[model samples]
Target: RASLPSGFRHLPGHFDRPAQEALVAELRQVITEAPLFTPVMPRTGKPFSVRMSNCGPLGWVSDLRGYRYQPLHPVTGRPWPAMPAVLTALWTELAPDAPPPEACLINFYTGDARMGLHQDRDEDTFDAPVVSVSLGDSALFRIGGQKRNDPTLSVRLASGDVALLGGAARLAFHGIDRLYPGTSTLLRDGGRINLTLRRVTRAA
Candidate 1:
């Protein structure tokens, strides 16, 4: 595989179409159990364009109270659905040195929906890397350095592609600029789904 900057690993077409479909089907069940909820911006209360849910023990949420991880769904008040073994296995294969992930954030995106550049810093430990899998459609993913003004790299993350943020790149700023509709057949609808595996607690 070609090398990227330190701590940044991009594996194109990491999962085949069949695997993507299988994962999507599994996520369907997760959505049924946990359901998707709109995450709000802290203080502003502005809702994000994407709807999200989680698998594993802790889930990330944002509302008037603020952005934080909780044991239960903000609305349903139930624990998050267990993460599928496919995801857990992927994480173990990709980040063997890190502890098992406790959270798998699922993001559903549609046309015109985009995530602004931000750092994933809420987790307690930096020892573990974040493993993100892209399914359905394609997204223009942006990556910048730790500083806000640093140079950035734009990569098209298509269905089945995976990216890992570890080491110095773990705290790098990143986000999805936009989605290219009709780019992939993984999702019957012209939208995208992103699965991110994270370790919320400090490594023991």
Candidate 2:
């Protein structure tokens, strides 16, 4: 395995099986309040491969207008579900100096769903790190430098694992290339759930 880019931290099995199950239980309630909706490209209106929902004061959404943080759900027209406490705790533990996260993007991947390489530049503050948690099946996570064409390294992220992209790597181009199915039994339906905790705005 090649060395990960600077400012990248990977914590394998950060959550034990019991803890992972507890987190999933909390997510079930979140999904009920804010159902997963397909996000489309800005102008092309092409839908992303993964289904997404959010829980926080602000939620990341995509549509004809493009990616931005908003307080309401696109489909429900209601405020997004409250950010789970477990996630907040995770962020605080890993990013003690950063502001409390305002957005927790829930990405549910099934079948062949995958995310493309991209920078998480939508947030107002780059000082805060993005804490990503993986559940269910494992997946091949790729990370590159600030530029899209920068050399990349692939990591196999499994259930209960956590990755923190902070400091220099906060704007790094990264995404999931593919998933290894049947790698875990965390999700009842046999897919993957990724929780990305991000601070959308600068602290007061």
Candidate 3:
């Protein structure tokens, strides 16, 4: 287990093969129901680099108008798939300081896909941490401070890896530089799937 700079926690290969396989199966079923789609950037209307969808009570959405959380899939107009129990358990274990995540954003990254540096600030609550699980191929995760241009650090996230960004680093600017193709033999073919759990709404 490697402790990331900027106080982020990197639990490498935390999930065993059985657990990873189970999570993948759950994700496949969720995708079959909800499907993955490219979200557009707010204002620009340009599609996001990474194809994404979600499960849980709410899902993250971005468009020409702006970014926000919605209860339904934009394409299907149906409620997003329910968050798998394994994910909920993992979140509880990894981020005990945070409340139960209200949204789980599943991002599908092909060999060429990449995410730009950005902070996750859509959630109303900042007291919780963000739990991210990586499956399939490896990816270069760039972690920086709260400021956009602060010095950053890079880490190779592999299958079954979990990264916890919480406490002071909860709002740190981070993104995926690029994915290392063909790293994991577990993926259906070859791709990276990242599940990020966050509390998008306040509990009433």
Candidate 4:
């Protein structure tokens, strides 16, 4: 893999096949408790192609009003499922210096779904790195400098891969350009699941 921007770490095959499978099983249970729901653009009210859910103490949500992190599910009005131990363990291993993660946003992307390049600025603090785990189908992950128009580069992120955006790349613009379906059998059906762990608030 080519050199990525500073503070950007990509660990390909970070989780072995068995580990990925176990994580998938855990996520299935998470979905049962926190059903996936479609998020909409704040003003246009157009739904995002990817469906979303969350775990941990807080969840990231976007709707007609705007994007923000809250303690409960927008649709269920109940607190999100607790973050899986596997995920919290990963955070402890990878981001030991940062505060424990409080939000794990789960994004489910089907074929033809794509996310435009954007910055993750909803959090109140940028001190902790944004840790992401990729599963199932491979994706073309595009990343660039903090500015939206900065020269961008794309990388193929396969299942079990883990990416960390911190320091200089913490506020970088990034997104999934497209998916290479059938690349991995992690998911029964062909699709991709992205688990993004973020520290939503500043540590005391």
Candidate 5:
């Protein structure tokens, strides 16, 4: 946990082999209901390197219109599948004090795909923490301060590892630098899958 910064916690191997397998099975089902779609950047409409999908009441989406949360898939126009019980249980176990998450953004990275430094700020509020669980391969996860240019730290997140962004680090700048293609055997085809659970709307 050297230089991990405050409020940003990384729990490596938080899910064990069997739990990870179960979650992967559930993710396969989620993909069937809401197949992955390529997301584009705002205005420029530049396609992201990763394919994305979601579960829960709302799903995060990006395009020429920018990032936002909606109940349905941007392409299929069908409501996202309900948040699987396993994910909900994880959230409850890790952050019992916070309200339950309403959106689970599923990202699938292949080849040399990587995400740039960014903050998760589109949500209505940051009262609840952003919980991310890594599966399939490993990624070099970067984290910086509230400012975009703040000094950063890098950590290798393996499958079943859980990372948390909450409290002071709720809006911290973080992203995936790259993936170690064969680091883990969780996915049959080889790649990395990430499940990021968040509270999209403010609690009543």
Candidate 6:
């Protein structure tokens, strides 16, 4: 169990083999029930690199205007699916200091798909840490300081790996550079699935 910096932590093989398989199955079911789609970027009106959807009380959405969380899916026009107990438990154990997460952003990435460096600033509360779990292929995670050109560190994240970003590093700029094809045996296709859990705001 290699720990991350004070504010960060990396749990290698965090989710056991069986647990990973079960999570994949649950995600597949959720996709079948809600489906995944590419969302447009704010202002530019361009589509995001990663195709994403959500399964929880709230879903993160981006549009020509900006990024925001909504109670309903823009495409399905229905409330997002409830968060799975497994995910909630993971969050509660990993980020006890953070508020209960209400949004689960599910991102599907192909070999070529890459996420640009950005901060998780849409949420109203910064008190909670962001919990990101990776499944399937391995990816190079580039993490940097709050500034754009600040020093950066790259870490290889594989299936069943969980990374936590919190405290001073909570607002760090991070992104995925690339995914190693056919690295993990869990995924049906040669790709990666990333689930990011966040506390959007204080409960009403």
Model 4: residue 12 alpha-carbon error in angstroms: 0.2
For model 4, residues 1-204, the per-residue Cα lDDT tens digits are: 255689999999999999999999999999999999999999999999999999999999999999999999999999999999999999999999999999999999999899989999999999999999999999999999988888888989999999999998999999999999999988998899999999999998
Q: Report the C-alpha lDDT of model 5 over 16-93, residue by residue, as the tens digit.
A: 999999999989999999999999999998999999999999999999998999998999999999999989998998
Model 2 Cα shift for residue 165 (angstroms): 0.4
Candidate 4 clash total? 0
Go through the candidates in order and give each one's C-alpha lDDT. 0.91, 0.94, 0.89, 0.95, 0.92, 0.88
The regions of model 1 sitting more than 4 angstroms off are 1-4
Report the number of the highest-lDDT candidate: 4
In model 5, residue pairs whose N, Cα or C atoms come closer than 3 Å (at least 3 residues apart or on different chains), thus clashing, are: none
- What is the total number of backbone clashes in candidate 5? 0
- Please identify model 4 stretches exceeding 4 Å from their true place: 1-3
* lDDT of candidate 1 over 1-204, digit per residue (tens): 133448999999999988988999999999999999999999899999999999899998889888788889988999999999999999999998778999999999999899999999888888899999999999999888888777888889999999998998899888899999998877887799999999999866
* TM-score of model 5 vs. true structure: 0.97
Point out where model 2 deviates above 4 Å. none
lDDT of 6 by residue, 1-204 (tens): 133335777888999999999999999888876788888888888888799989888899998878999998888898888888899999999977666889999999996999999888998888888899999999999888777787788899999999988887798888999999989989877799999999998756
The pairs that clash in candidate 6 are 43-64
Model 3: how far residue 184 lies from native, Å? 0.8
The Cα error of candidate 4 at residue 91, in Å, is 0.5
Better of 2 and 4 by lDDT: 4
Off by over 4 Å in 5: none
lDDT of 2 by residue, 17-67 (tens): 999999999999999999999999999999999999999999999999889
TM-score of each: 0.97, 0.98, 0.95, 0.98, 0.97, 0.95
lDDT of 3 by residue, 66-162 (tens): 9899999999999998999999999988777667899999999996899999999988987878889999999999887888988888889999999
Between candidates 2 and 6, the one scoring higher on lDDT is: 2
